[model samples]
Target: MDVKLTEEEKIKVLNSDDIYGIMQKILLRESKIDQNREHFWVIGLENNHRILFIELISLGTVNKTLAEPMEVFSFALQKRAVKIILCHNHPSGELRPSEGDKDITDKLIQVGIIVNTEVLDHLIISTKSYLSFADTGLLSELKKSTKYIPQYVLEERLKKQATEIANKKKTVEIAKEFKRNGVDNETIALSTGLSIEEVEKLRVRKR
Candidate 1:
């Protein structure tokens, strides 16, 4: 890496791991001077995952920063970047991500999917240590989560859940009808796939 990484040099070869290495150095140097203020940055990458540019998205108080997906992606779009890596400092020297950190990462990833600018990773940085969502498997967990899944996958999952819920409701209705007749709790439980306790509750509700 040159003292000032030439654009040609940057584009010739660089992966996320390489960028992570570079950021480690840069962040270490910067952190020595001001470790009390949080800073958020977005690194724009070419389609090949080479560095296009790094932009500071926002600066905030000691513990938190305000970063918006729109603003982050707007810069990426302006630079014609096809991918981005998000990085932020904790200032409190905490490398562990907060709930707010994960929330924003999920939101940015969703935005990136919509805009065709893929989110590569989110790094939580401190002077002494750092956490990579990509490396630690948190990003993978988020992708697998029903709450943070891509829109298409989530919609399909929701449809399946709705069908399952409807089936359960119908079973409950049938159980109610059985109870109203003369079916015992044990028989109603077996017929409706519900517990005896649930059948008892349904019977009590009728009375």
Candidate 2:
């Protein structure tokens, strides 16, 4: 059977990776840390045939222990994503937005605009359901006073900080800790928002 694809259908198929679904799966696996983790969902939206379905770009996670926008948006930019829908699972299952979540969304929306992308929605998802900041009119308020930061500038600052951290570690044990835990230089670069060179320097010091 020959199937004729509508333009909208074509786009959906083209971007059928289902990033949100993947995020849901990841969150389910991380149930142990559900109460303290934040997940970022970055997606791209293409306007074709007057329909907008999200294209999966990348995913990042921030624990209550480490919430960093640099780590989040870096993946988005790497994916060349044109839009994003940020989501985090609330282990407590409370469908309310926290102050910190609001603040981060505000900053991300601003950054998105500066980077020529759109922050379409921020969702707080639980096992049972979800909340959409855009649908609730919260995003409209945030769009009014968004502060823009260039991606390159953010990356440069993160690189310097990572380098500093690497410089301070003066033990083979710390380096081995990174390697034994399956934390290679590339993983360290991603986790710390550092450059590969900096992570390599740390590895070299260990040897």
The candidate that achieves the highest lDDT relative to the unseen native structure: 1
On residues 40-149, what C-alpha lDDT tens digit does candidate 1 reach at each position? 88888887777888887887888878998778988899989988889888877778899999988888887787799988888887666678899899988775555556
Please report, as a residue range, the 10-residue window in candidate 1 with the lowest summed lDDT: 1-10
- Clashing pairs for predicted structure model 2, backbone only: none
RMSD of each candidate relative to the true structure: 9.4, 20.0
Once fitted onto the true fold, the runs of candidate 1 whose alpha carbons sit more than 4 angstroms away are 1-17, 28-33, 148-153, 156-207
Highest-TM-score candidate: 1
lDDT of 2 by residue, 77-100 (tens): 665656666666665678698877
Per-model lDDT:
0.78, 0.58
lDDT for model 1 comes to 0.78
TM-score of 1: 0.64
Q: What is the lDDT of residue 73 in candidate 2?
A: 64
Q: TM-score of the candidate numbered 2?
A: 0.50
